[model samples]
Target: VGSAAVVFQAARLESVPDRVSTLPEVEIQLFRDAVVQVQEEMKEIKERMADVLPAEERALFDAYVMMLESETLIDATIQRIRDGNWAPGALRHTIEENARVFEQMEDPYLRERASDIRDLGERILARLQSSEQRRTGWPQRTILVGEEISATQLAEVPREALAGVVSATGTGSSHVAILARAMGIPTVMGVTDLPVERMEGREVIVDGYQGRIYLQPSERVREEYLRLYEEEQALSASLREHAAEPAVTPDGHAVPVLVNGGLIADLKPSYVEGADGVGLYRTEIPFMIRDRFPAEEEQYQLYRQVLEAFAPRPVTLRTLDVGGDKPLPYFRFEEDNPFLGWRGIRITLDHPEIFLTQIRAMLRASEGLDNLHILLPMVSSLNEVEESCRLIEQAWQELCDEGRRLVYPQVGVMIEVPAAVYLVPALARRVDFLSVGTNDLVQYLLAVDRNNAHVADLYDSFHPAVLQALAQIADGAHHAGKPVSICGELAAVPEAAILLLGLGFDSLSVSVAALPRLKQVIRGFPLERSRALASEVMQSESSAEIRDRLRQALIEQGLGGLIRAGLH
Candidate 1:
């Protein structure tokens, strides 16, 4: 279902050289007009960001606005244009001068700001280029293919026009990837060694889930894909028929199926009714889309809306999980291994103010509501949990002191690191609940980087050791009388969901796209059969053996379509 084939253009930014030449008054006026136009657009962009982005992130555009209004930068551009240079060239020269000066700075943060300056410069240059020659035509059913699609470039792509996107290099953590997902566009990144320049505007099939791009298809292949797509549509229709129904099995086991993402509407029109509530409210959405950390009030408004939308139903909000793959423009760090570096609770702990701001906003959002739940991401130590607890208390107290109505919402830790899995028994006792982020947990447990396409085959969630760890974590949490749910992508796989159910996970959270299939699988097998399957899977020695066993069992149980349909 996560696949689409379309005739698309190999879109690439055409580099324009701002030349050193004389410009007349008319040209200078045009440059002024471009600047004013861009400034007006930036204002609209900022307002749009406020609704979707956190305050600090919305502040990103502030710098761009300031740069546009900066008398120094603006004067330099004007002087260069008046001194006989193309307006675009004059702007670029000023951008390069500022970049050069910033690059020479001694302070690391100041040096990093050079990147922002460069980014703004590019935006301005792009505007200048567009003023010269505006694009009025986009081919039908286009898929944007490029080495990388910047945030600025992505915004220019008409949302209603682009069918999908294929990138030669990008990770799931990249901002482009996040934007693509938010736009509901099918995208496959890290596609290597394709002659895209020559194949611009060619028919291709993009399988996002499989990470395959079929360049040119014969009639046979095209027909096959068409058949698969139609089959997918029919199956999706059948699954959505029971959207409002609870995830209950033949034996009357009702397991709450929750959807994970930043927005509640992300699940609407299909699986929203089926979903219980937010399992992993990735708080980083605002951060990822913006240039800086969100402000306290800006963060609060966003949090309050989400809480109000799903009031009374539990909504787990994951605090800032930044660093590494998800880097902020304002906060830059050098890490040998970023995933293990200053991230998640580490970032919050290190920056207490940032942590407190988020906590205060979260608590205040719960003003008269009890559905707000705070989850600390990438927590691996008791000290981190204790420190977070202290901050949470301090923030809650501070808000109460301010005469703000608030509640001490439930606090939880995400079990993504192996250390967390081992510490679950202790962590469960400290936190109200636990969630296994299998995407990171599997890689951490297996010592594999799923981002490395070369060894992606090694990133198996079905590994016996991984399965054992899940079982242990689930058991420990339940033993401590704390509920545990899985919010990782793995939890959405029908086969994996079946195994998780068998593994004793109290609940499971997945994307809306996978909700129906997951529910179907849950309803297909009774609790006893799932538990039995889980027991057998845990006993298996290897992933291959486990897969074979599960396939046979699913077929024998008349649920083979779950595997054949690729939901497994």
Candidate 2:
């Protein structure tokens, strides 16, 4: 639903042509200093990659570092300069000649290496050009339309001026999407047949959420987009104002509103945005972004940081939930139906050492505090939970054997798979808590992969079956004297948040951006009214009907502002 009006500008990413046209008297020291600066920049880039990109993919940056630090390249450039050639010209000529030689190689691998070298040379040239006081004059509020964007250019986007990004190619998991999300910029990737070349300087509307852009939109469309953007900004400001307020219902019920995915860099902001605690600190990110499985000490430091960041505020860490759509490069295996394939606790159960290392780290990270809770993802069988708990027991004993004092954290299961709903009653007994992952549950129950554009429409979390399962899981956990929470993409929707609160979930975890609006929506209703809304929704059979009824119900309950604000 997020949309913006933006001006399109192709990045100034051209490499130095073989025939050098402009001649500037640049000092040799400037060349030397720029190389060192780029080396440090590349090193910083690698360190930053640890937080986001997996270590394997970070070879791109490592290559740039090697190219900059290469004695062969550096010595050749210096020798050419000593022969009295212009520094920039000499450097470009030397790099380009090498790239030419590499490009002529019979090996495809060597040819690809040639392309990488040319790219690195272009980047170094761009930096040197900037150092020479040549500036890129970017227009205001750029959509940054491009066929492709490098990770380096992606990182250096003037975030303050970025309206959004439109790429002709890239998927949701692409680095472009990752960086754009981190910068909170709206971005549309994988757009095909977009006549961007002809549409330059035309007022365009980019809908990142919908992956569509309108060139020279009609007045009606222009007004609509402007309204949407205004409401979004106003709503964000309004939400931030109430960031410190408790999420209490009108009837004085306290429903803890937690934050999902407190990756190391995002913790402080989540807290500032009024997250009560971390309901789901996804641990898969560490595994997903690294080339190799992070060692015990590395995992221990991250878990400890999370605990310390929100001390006294509980953090629930979900074990590695990979193997489905998130196949590790290290663990390559074929699967006909990956969503139902080896994933979550299933993968960990088969690989005991992987499971043990993580469990032991979480246990040790808990050290003196009891705030850390471990959640088992995609649990379908009671054995997954039991075996994981047994490992937890053994981990605690090993810690004791080492003479380190530690408090054991609570173990919980995420009811995501369809089989998990029926097993909740059994799962409740063996676990300390339950969390309903509506995103996966809805997809699995409906047999619809939401990522599939053709079937995305059918993947409704508002399905009657989804509502019923949510209620069952919550009640099952409550009946067993354990608290339950809803930590999924669905919880971030304001209407869905209200409906979930009505479903008797003790807590709801959503993105930090949705906190203020969601809290505002939840506080608008009395617990009794939400229950009535949930009950009415549960009575309906059609997903569309349920959605309509909920919207009407929210409006009747005097929370229609969210409707106008485009909370959907």
Q: Please identify model 2 stretches exceeding 4 Å from their true place.
A: 1-204, 208-212, 216-220, 269-273, 564-568
Candidate 2 RMSD to the correct structure: 10.2
**Tens digit of per-residue lDDT, candidate 1, span 1-568:** 1222122222112223334343357667776777777778888999987879999888877778888889767889888878876676577678778888989999997898888887776666666565653344455666776665555455556666766777766655344665565555667777778555445546877666566778777778787777866776687788888767888999999999887877535634454567788898888867766777889899989998888777778889999988766677688989999877888889889889988988888888888887888999998899999999989999888888999877689999999998888898899889899988887888888887656645666778889998989899989999999999999877766678888888899899877667777888888889899899898778889899987787677677677665544442
Candidate 1 whole-model C-alpha lDDT, 0 to 1: 0.76
TM-score list, all predictions? 0.75, 0.70
lDDT of each: 0.76, 0.74
Q: How many residue pairs collide in each prediction?
A: 6, 1
What are the root-mean-square deviations of the candidates from the true structure over C-alphas? 10.7, 10.2
Off by over 4 Å in 1: 1-142, 149-163, 170-187, 264-271, 564-568
Q: What is the lDDT of residue 429 in candidate 1?
A: 80
**Candidate 2, 112-171: lDDT as tens digits:** 888777666665665666575332444477666655544444534465666777766564
Show pairs that collide, candidate 1: 21-84, 21-85, 22-84, 56-293, 56-294, 56-295
lDDT for 346 in candidate 1 is 92
